[model samples]
Target: MKIQTKINGHLREDEVEPRLLLVHYLRDVAGLTGTHIGCETSLCGACTVLLNGEAVKSCTLFAVQADGGEITTIEALGNHEKLHPLQEGFWEEHGLQCGFCTPGMILAAYQLLCRNPHPSREEIRKGLEGNLCRCTGYQHIVKAIEYAAQKIGSPDA
Candidate 1:
């Protein structure tokens, strides 16, 4: 089937199979590989992406289901020259180790900050319960989110 969606600010139309997971479609067809694939069972948020401004596991969704929806991956956040506040916070706070879960973590944090603006550490933890990061043990990740929230004028300060 032909699915049309806006991805990373670009309007794209493609023919994808009903079984084609959104992750593969984004990586292969959309050329956005920042969204990694860790556990396809949805246990890991490695393939997290924003579906209509909310974080969702890409592997848990089919490309066809995303038709006409707005999708935002890590690539949508920022680029080499300019980094989003979340990306900058991750870098400044050393939030990533192996970098496997960084993309999803940032996206999830981005969504949380967008909605709440100011979130407590516990709220941040709860918001990111679906995203698992094995490298940093989550302290730096939480700090990174907190830093971003502060920088962006979120209430978490």
Candidate 2:
């Protein structure tokens, strides 16, 4: 199947198998490996990405289903030269240890902050319940989200 979708602000049109998972399409076909594939059953949020401004687990959807949609992977966020607030927060707060779950966690927090820029710690915890991290014990992750919220909610930010 031929699917056309906008990814990271670029238009992409490619041929993919109807059964191809969106995560595989992003990593293998599109060469965007930032969207990780962990538990493909959606138990892990390793493949989370924004589809049309809402976060969705890429592992749960087919590439063809994302046809004509807009997808934002972790790469779309600010890079090393100018890190996104979430990225900076993760680093500043040591939110990640192994770093395998950082991308999805950050993206999930991104959606949460978008919906509620000033999320309480409990709210952050509730917001990120879908994503699980084996490292960092989640305390630092919560702090990272709080840092991002403060930065994003600030007048200077």
Candidate 3:
């Protein structure tokens, strides 16, 4: 099947088999490898990406299922020259250790903040339930999301 989707602000069309996972399509065919493949069962959220502005595990869905959707990978988030606020917050707050889960974590946090600009700490935790970070125990990761929320919105303004 031929699937057309907007990925990382770019329009792309690729032919893929019915069994082709979105994660593999993104990493191999599309040449975007930031989204990792950990537990392919969708429990890990390591392959998390925004499909139509919602977090979805790429490995859990076939590329054909993503046809005509807007997909955003970690690569679309930002870069070294101008990192997204979530990325900066993660770095400043030490939100990651091994870095394997950073992309998914950041994307998950970004999706949460987009929907809830001023999420409480507990809410942040709930929003990130799909993602598993095996390194830091998520204290700092939660804080990083909190920081991004506060920065994105503040009553002090």
Steric clashes per prediction: 3, 0, 0
Clashing pairs in 1: 117-154, 118-155, 118-156
Q: Candidate 3: misplaced stretches above 4 Å?
A: 154-157
- TM-scores of the models, in the order given: 0.95, 0.99, 0.95
What's every prediction's RMSD, in angstroms? 2.2, 0.6, 1.7
Q: lDDT-based ranking, best first?
A: 2, 1, 3
Stretches off by above 4 angstroms in model 2 are: none
Error of 2 at 32 (Å): 0.6
Tens-digit per-residue lDDT, 5-97, candidate 3: 899889998889999999999999999999999999989888999999999999999999999999999998878998778988898899999
Residue 112 accuracy (lDDT) in model 2: 98
- Please report how far candidate 3 places residue 48 from its true position, in Å: 0.5
Candidate 2, which ten residues in sequence have the lowest lDDT sum? Answer: 148-157
Better of 2 and 3 by TM-score: 2
TM-score of 1: 0.95
Comparison by lDDT, 1 against 3, better one: 1
